[model samples]
Target: MTIACILVILPFCLALAAFSDLFTMTIPNRISAILLAAFIVVAPLAGFGMGEISLHIAAAAVVFVVCFCLFAASVMGGGDAKLLTASAVWFGLDASLVDFLVYVSIFGGLLTLAVLLLRRQENAILASGIPVPQLLLTAKKIPYGIAIAMGGFAAYPSSPLMEAAFRATFVTTA
Candidate 1:
């Protein structure tokens, strides 16, 4: 049951964040809070040692610091920073963390380009009677939460928590 919850919650939260950002241009604080809180509760139950948990916390801290700087510089949104930090906790200090960051950067660039292109076609879209979300059409900000969520999903299968869950499932089945 715990393993199921752990597996479900991460992707569920990521989906929520992505959808919210896509439609509303905001990733709710509650989504980030839930992610952080769930990881704290679930990691130990999934067989993470104290040292591993500490490293996860450290990963989050490092991400938070970098994201905070980006936020301060107005290069990233506050909600995006929080979401990225929370997601980092799941990856911990591992190669998966690097993969997550790389995926996010790549996805972010792609998303930005797509949004920019879409914005350029806003007038044509409106003239064609297609309803588009005002946030997507008019907002100068890119919904970076989409990229973060994508990165989380891309990296999640290789995360320690997911590996533990898989091992537990295999052990039970065997």
Candidate 2:
């Protein structure tokens, strides 16, 4: 239970900071460092034993490599990639990590759509309020930290109620 709490809270806090920094275009090293350290410490703890420890390490490596590739393509900010990799390392091949990432993607897509709509609204408001065309030239970057937090929240229900519900429905269908 304690570990589960840590797993949920740590990501949410880091994500809040990240979202703030992303909007301001500043990346703090402290939060990123803590995330990295936490992973190194917790991965072994999450493991069942020696055999599972190896899997954790492997998951970390996989996440790192994937982040590196995203960074190389410039699709992701360096800080974003770093934090994501650190979170994945901490999670260490767990189902929770899978759920977290899946929700992250879903939330990210929603965020993008909202940002686009906001951009359009901002353009219309600015156009009517100001005479300058250059004011529209600046594009706002979406702060992704909030999306991460949303993902964490969506995944953090501790009860096995979802699983039980699924089973109940499955029995009905059968």
Candidate 3:
């Protein structure tokens, strides 16, 4: 049961957020809520102690502060900020968190570049009836949730909770 939760929750949430942002230009609050709530429930089952869980919450707080500043500056959408903040808890303040952030940066840059290139060909694509999401072609804001999701998938295995879950699953199964 714990292994199932660990395997499904974060990845499913991230993927859903990415697709929702891609097509609708918004991520629903429920995705973030589910992620945060699931972590609260599953962290202990995965063998994280109080201190480690505190660190995870601290990471989320730190990410929230940074994301809040970006939202205030109009540099990031509210949904994006919330998603990043919620996702940060899985990594805590460890090297995995650093890896997650780095992946986010790289993916964000690449996604931005791809979006820009697509926009440059927007007129042609529009004429050709390729059926891309209209928001992808016209929105001023990038769907940063896509980058966040990509980064989350890339770095999630290194997260401590995931490692603990893996160990637990292997020990039980073996």
TM-score of each: 0.98, 0.67, 0.98
Clashing pairs in 1: none
Native-to-model Cα distance after best TM-score fit, residue 97 in candidate 3, in Å? 0.6
Ranking by lDDT: 3, 1, 2
* lDDT over C-alpha atoms for residue 96 of model 1: 91
In angstroms, the error of model 2 at 122 is 1.2
Model 2 spans with C-alpha error above 4 angstroms: 1-9, 42-50, 124-140, 156-174
Clashes of each: 0, 0, 0
lDDT of 1 by residue, 1-174 (tens): 878987899899999999999999999999999999999999888889999999999999999999999999999999999999999999999999999999999999999999999999999998998877888999989999999989888989998889999999999899
Q: Quick one: RMSD of model 2?
A: 7.6
Winner by lDDT between candidate 2 and candidate 1: 1
Worst 10 residues of 1 by lDDT: 1-10
Write candidate 2's Cα lDDT for 1-174 as tens digits. 435534454655566665655455444656667766654554444434666656656766787798799879977767666666655544556686688788879988987797666567776757688442332234455556656667756764531222333444567689
Query: Once model 3 is optimally superposed onto the true structure by TM-score, how far is the C-alpha of residue 28 displaced, in angstroms?
Result: 0.4
Clashing pairs in 3: none
- The local lDDT score (0 to 100) that residue 109 gets in candidate 1 is 98
